[model samples]
Target: NTTPTAVADAGDATEKGGVANGSGGVVASGNVLTNDTDPDAGDTKTVTAIKFGATSGTLGSALAGTYGSLVLNASGAYSYAVNETNAAVQALRLSTNTLSEVFSYTMRDTAGATATANLTVTIHGANDAPVLAVQTTTQNATVGSAFSFVVPTTTFTDVDSGETLAYAATAADGTALPAWLSFNATTRTFSGTPTAGGTYGVKVTATDLGGLAANETFNIAVSVPGNTTPTAVADAGDATEKGGVANGSGGAVASGNVLTNDTDPDSGDTKTVTAVVFGATSGTLGSALAGTYGSLVLNASGAYSYAVNETNAAVQALRLSTNTLSEVFSYTMRDTAGATATANLTVTIHGANDAP
Candidate 1:
């Protein structure tokens, strides 16, 4: 058979317009050998090889291009696809620039005679969607306090040239904006002095003129000032065994943290023992105070040590009568917001036998 002549046609396609995934768009579908000819009675020609410039490719397989891929079949059918994720391919979305690729293929006849032809694929650029850098966030506000947040315009980006973005706000559920908050679409700002304390969800969207959009969701927590005061619950100390009446040394001591049970209405506030004293709020912390039957030493951490004065008349009397005596000490706790509360710590002294 005589050598076969291969002929290819040029095709055009729009980037990302072919398939749902933009992987490839069909340029033109027709038999590659329909326009080819073979001299010798009824000698048929079939595609045997494909090449792009100096790079060789296999027939019936997909070949990668500078910004996309192409596949050619032995039957002469072919497809071209744009790589949407390719950085260079993405750059095309910035402008109306077009890119082209030339593919050459060889067709062989029955007698092993072959010829080559060229097919050109032109890819037209298209617009890309905007993307959000920060997807979700949480903000804070306070009742009767000024709260303001500005959307990060620089974080939202669109690759299209000369493309402008518009901002909008809605409830996180895509409803109307909350009544207590205000948003400026022009300035991309959120500002309001909330009258109530609650968690408000917001959705901010950045949209291009093409209606392609990107959005982020966030929450704003508003707190009521001084709504809940610090609570100081009365605490008890470990019981102590009374020392002998004749014993001149200190008896078994009792110690504990008086602020352990203390709390604040606000979960965020931390309660701390600001003062520990007897019958008053202003007392030297970490100082020892004399009680009826014992001396109590208290510290700023709400830890107090009470030592029974066994030699005292009242303490000695308790041992003789097999009785119990208790000493009460006062402490003051404060929250981070300066809310203070006072509570008492009671330590009981149990009478014990005196040894000879």
Candidate 2:
């Protein structure tokens, strides 16, 4: 049998022109055998196998690629679909502005004789739109401190090769930022000291040279100045010591609101517990602190609980003495206007008879 001489043709594909205003990918399809031919008498052509670089395999129809998928029909027709998010492809496109994949296909004759030939597909680049990393952001500030936020350059991206982005900020309603706030297009930052109290919204836009743009919104709430210090009242509570000697097992818990009688001179101002410090140690939010004689758990809403350790030798000695003991804790509270107050809480433990 005479071996069929298989000739292959080159193909072209574009990495651009897909979804999201061409920020995605596209498909390239053509007949790879369009310029190929078999020099055998009465021989019919058939695609039997495919090979890419060092790898060789049977190709009844399709093969996958690093940046896309490739399919080859028996008739020699082929299609290559590019993956837009492929990092390698993006890097190549950005560096050299071009990409390509080359592979060889084996053609068989009706008589079973075959030959192989190569084909290459070149991918061209094009402009794509910029996309926002985050669509919206929220922030809070008080009048006493200057407010500032910088929009990261990486916040907006253009998948197309080596593209730069420009930024701008405005009111969400397409107006100017409030007088108290100023936006710097060059720095991609919002800065200024707020002079009033209210919720404000600003829209930020990132645009590429191709006129394609992406937008993000910032919702900022600034507090009014002239804050009045809030009062943190000294609180008191009582607990009965359990009649046991085991650590953490025989303890009595005392619960109360440390801010029950606290007040803020500013009208309509609300205060919340911000921190609790016992001596030189401080407790984390939503967590408990181990005190000298027990453990104290405090919440942001001013509610607190103290567990008295009946196993403490000093606490057990109280039963023989005055039959009582006292523990004090310090906590801080902040009002809506930013004023803060610190106070103490005293918890009394009454000794009870043990069942020795």
Off by over 4 Å in 2: 1-3, 16-25, 90-96, 134-137, 140-146, 228-266, 270-356
Assess every candidate by TM-score: 0.54, 0.58
What digit string (tens of lDDT, one per residue) describes model 2 on residues 35-104?
Answer: 6566667878878777787766555545766666678888877888777667556544332377788888
lDDT of 1 by residue, 1-356 (tens): 57778877776666552122334333534566888987699787788888887888887788877766778898888887766666555545522567777888888998888898988877766666777654344466778888899887775877655679999999987998878788999988899888876557688888877677877765675656865766789987654555444564335678888877887768777666655555422245677787777778877677778887766766665553347888787766666654456788888876666655
Candidate 1's C-alpha runs over 4 A off are 1-5, 13-28, 37-43, 90-97, 108-113, 125-131, 154-163, 225-356
**Highest lDDT, which number?**
2
Error of 1 at 323 (Å): 61
Best by TM-score: 2
Q: Which window of 10 residues has the lowest lDDT sum in candidate 2? A: 87-96
* lDDT of model 1 at position 176: 89
Provide the RMSD of all predictions against the true structure, rounded to 1 decimal: 22.7, 14.7
**Local distance difference test, candidate 2:** 0.72
Q: List the residue pairs that clash in candidate 1.
A: 24-81, 32-76
Q: Rate the local accuracy (lDDT) of all candidates.
A: 0.71, 0.72
